[model samples]
Target: MAREVDPKKTRKALRRLKRARKKIEDSEKSDTLSDWEDEFLGSVEDRLETFGSAFNDPEKGHLDEALSGLQTAKLREIERKAAGKARKPMSRGKGFKSSFKRKGSGPRVRDINEDIEEETPEADEIPEAAAEPSRPSGPPKLRVVKGDKGDT
Candidate 1:
């Protein structure tokens, strides 16, 4: 025989559960809890533990550990989002095609050829008399004389 559940008792229990959940949600938003709230949460945790979920224990510092882990994960996600935003989308299609001629091409080639012609003397042209050596003109040339150490 199935024992029939009392609808009134079930409704009252459901309302109480809803109220507790609301309180917890409000506490989470405020990020502060009074002693009574702590005691209430501890009792809820004990009830949850009986069901084998083993929710975070404030006395064991598990709350801080969980909070730190959550904060780190949130920071990492924020960093990832920021990095994603920072990247620019790659340009598609042909992109910027410069109309200017490259080096050694077009007018530059003509300028280079003219420069080369100006620098080089024609083979048939008679060269001017070679200039006097600049160094020997400044000072007497030094000659190295090797002598036996014993003679020195």
Candidate 2:
């Protein structure tokens, strides 16, 4: 016969499992510091600790303010770095292959504009169904409709 677990032990195990799952969910939602940020924060902590030991009780409040200011500056620098990266141009051609020498029957890889032209039908090759498809003759117009109290 298989050994049976005690009810108390089973309940405790369930509670621990629930707590572990909650902890994992919370960690996933939280933003973790990068290696550089962690190093900076560690240095800040050391600075704070040094200040704690070097200064007397009278200057503790000033130390706290200094720590807060350093933390704010660190956060702002990280934000500025992210914003600068976002503003950088995306036309660097990263991951784009410049030459093609394949062993198969496929056209060599082309750039964005060339790929579009290759995929679309030529102006003369379009069939009647596509050559004169039904479409509005001119640009679409937007009109205001009257609502309650003649308000648009």
Candidate 3:
């Protein structure tokens, strides 16, 4: 039995491919397209035309999708580049200085020796009775409280 294919997905894929190609072509007149980008567009167009989908591997993309998520992202990136938009920079994440932050500007942890070297005068000022927690005088008092007897 032949596998069922959505005519909509096929048509949409073709439309997207043509638009991307047209964008690239138009951009090429004013800007240069890298060899890899040109080759990528051509290969994807060919694959879609011949196989009805650019990739067949389920691991690469959904069986019904013409372009994988990564493929679509790359396509958008190319489009952005062609349009003269700058690509967003990657994040360095925490525990490191950010692009805007000046060197040694962030809060720094002091050395253990520095804490030990500086003795606090407050330690001697506190009274001995207040310094330690109060001891319990005796065993806690017991109360024979009666609950509502209605449930029983």
The C-alpha RMSD of each candidate to the native structure, in angstroms, is 19.8, 22.8, 10.2
Q: Show pairs that collide, candidate 1.
A: none
lDDT of 1 by residue, 46-115 (tens): 5433432222444542331222234334333333333333434555856454654367744533445655
Q: Tell me the tens digit of each residue's lDDT in model 2 across 1-152.
A: 32233445334433433343344345543444467765664554454444422223333433323334345445445444433333344467635465645678978676787556446777788877767667887889999987679535
Q: Which of candidates 1 and 2 is the stronger one according to lDDT?
A: 2
* TM-score attained by model 1: 0.20
TM-score of every prediction relative to native: 0.20, 0.23, 0.56
Error of 3 at 1 (Å): 9.1
Worst 10 residues of 2 by lDDT: 52-61
For all candidates in order, the CA lDDT equals 0.42, 0.47, 0.73
Q: Candidate 3 — which residues are off by over 4 angstroms? A: 1-5, 90-108, 111-114, 117-152
lDDT of 3 by residue, 1-152 (tens): 33244668767877876776677677746545678887887888787777777776678777677777777777777777767678888766776445557667657778788657666459789879778787889899899988878764
Worst 10 residues of 1 by lDDT: 63-72
Query: How many residue pairs clash per model?
Result: 0, 0, 0
Model 3: lDDT equals 0.73
Report how far residue 56 has shifted in candidate 3, in Å.
Answer: 1.4
Candidates, ranked, lDDT: 3, 2, 1
